[model samples]
Target: MSFITLNITCSEEKRELLIAELSLFPFDAFEETETGLLISCEEADWEEEPVFAVLARYEVECRVERVEKVNWNEEWEKNYDPVIVEDQCIVRATFHEPRPDFPYEIIITPKMSFGTGHHATTYQVLKHQLQLDHKGKKVLDVGCGTGALAIMAHKRGATDITAVDIDEWCIENSEENFSLNGCDHVKLSLGGIETVQENDPFDIILANINKNVLLDQIGAYSERLKNKGTLVLSGFYTEDIADLMAEAGKFGLVHQEQTERNRWAMLALKKE
Candidate 1:
């Protein structure tokens, strides 16, 4: 299938917000540019109306182009760099040689999926995961783009994982990535948070979605967590921490710790 690219020029503030807004759509990859952001998705899944409608609200310049006969894997690998954190964790494409020195190395080809650990939100969450104990824990990865976070949890010794994403492309990309990493036990679910069965509660729930979705689903995360289970949240600005923390508190999830990078923050809350 061919891919379509969308270019939108907006203020830095609007760039991140637009990424969050557009993420709900079928877009698979997003890149922030000096002047704006570049978004890509399957040609069949691209919808001009919702994209332009969201862009119009923010008063950003928009351009759409369909790219045919493009080998995205080669294009991505040519430009993709390994995402390294504290010299400990490395998220790289398969083309990059493995780093045995790093305690954790995750291989994920960039198909424009969101959670490759390049973004500050994903980076902070990955760093936070390193600090938490995931041995034999049941984990849930909400908005599991590329299933990167779910794979990380597995490395930390999580035996059971449910990686859920609203985008089908993400699920497809995640399935491939999970296999690449030999994560056979990770359950890949394609649907909204509400659709996931809550009978099997999680010990650690990682959600790195936007503020609106996080707020709306805080209660659900609460309902799906085992007692004292931790919920790690990111994908919002640091200024949003208070609002998100307050909402999470209402669900009896107490703020335990926080980490920030590039103004994006990751918050860990424990079920009280």
Candidate 2:
């Protein structure tokens, strides 16, 4: 299907917030730019009122255009580059040659899915995962875009892994990536955390979604976590950490550590 592309030019200070707000809509994918964000959604899902309202509120320059459907693979190949993190993991596409030096190699075919280790949030999360002990643990990957994090957990010896997302395309893309990386054991589900049974708590939860979504679901995450269980969160600016931590503290989660890159932050917390 063809899509509407919103090319927005706003202050870098407002970029994260803009992306978060735009995410609330049916916008399925985002591409960050030097000045602002490039967002895409199916034409049928595009509502001019909300888009114009957000732009007006932010007071940003926006250029709206219709993008014809084309070969997504070719588009990605032209733009997507392999990402290497901490010299430990290499996230590449099927078109890239093997890098035998890296301990963990992830091959993903990112069609419309998000996570590819290119974004700062995804990179920091992958770096943190390198230091974690995932062996035989019950890992839950919330907002499992492209199933990158879940596949990493599986490779790290996590036997019981559940990856959930609200997007059906993400589920299908993640399944393809899991198979590509030979991690078919990772359980995939559609919808949010509520779709998963609450009978058994998880040893670790990876949520790489935006700040607003994190705040709204913090309680649920806390409830689903086992005592002393780890929670890693990203997809927000570093400046938002204090507010996020304060909200998380209300749910009995203690801040452990954090990592930042390019003004983006990933926080690690433990259930007290």
Candidate 3:
């Protein structure tokens, strides 16, 4: 299918804000350019008003265009680079040659989906995941873009891994990634946390989505976590940590630690 592309030019300082704001819309994929961002959404879901509204709110300039269907995988292959975390986990595309020294290798084809391990949030989460004991544990990967985290969890011996995302593109991308990594046991689903039944709680939950979605679903995350379970969160600035911690505290989730990269922070919370 074709897509509506929005070439947004904003101040470097406001780039993250614009990305966050645009995510609330139906926009699906984003690529950071030297001067701005390239965002796209399915033509059927594109709405001019919301896009213009967001640009106006940020006081940014934009150019809209209709993008014809292209070979996304081929495009990604040309630009995609492998990411290695702490020399333990490596995330790479199938086209790239493997580095056998890394204990865990996750092969992914991130066609419009996020969480390719190049992002600081995903990198920090992978670093923290290496520290945890996922062997035979039940894991829930919320907003599992590219299913990178979920696949990593499976590689780390997580027995019951459930990866969920609201975007159908993410679901499809994640499924292919899971299969690429030979993570057949990782269950891929399309929806939010509410889609998962309450009867099954999780030992570890990973949420790398935006702040608003995290805030809105903090309670649900707490409810779904088993006693003394772990919750790793990201996709927000370091400044937002205090507020997020305060909300998690209400549900007995104690702040364990945090990692940051380029002002983006990933928080580790433990349910008491």
> What order do you get sorting by TM-score, best first?
1, 3, 2
Order of candidate numbers by lDDT, starting with the best: 2, 1, 3
Structural RMSD, model 2: 3.6
lDDT of the candidates, in the order given: 0.86, 0.87, 0.85
Q: Which candidate should be chosen as best, given TM-score against the real structure?
A: 1
lDDT per residue as tens, model 2, 52-128? 99889989999888877744456456556789999899999998899988999989887657788877899899999
Could you give candidate 3's per-residue lDDT for residues 66-153 as a string of tens digits? Answer: 8787454564565567888998988888888987888999898766677878677888899999998899999999999889989889
Output the worst ten-in-a-row residue range by lDDT, candidate 3: 70-79
Candidate 1 clash pair list: 29-112
Candidate 1 lDDT over residue span 1-272, tens digit each: 78898767777557667877888898766765556677788999978887788888999998788887456566565556788988889999898888899999998965756777777888898999998999999999999988999999999999989989988878988999999999988989899789778898999999988898999999999999999999999988899999998888788999899987767888999998
Query: Which of candidates 1 and 2 reaches a greater TM-score?
Result: 1
Q: Which pairs clash in model 2?
A: none
Instruction: Give the C-alpha miss distance for residue 69 in model 2, angstroms.
Output: 7.2
Query: Which pairs clash (backbone N, Cα, C closer than 3 Å) in model 3?
Result: none
What lDDT is obtained when candidate 3 is compared to the true structure? 0.85
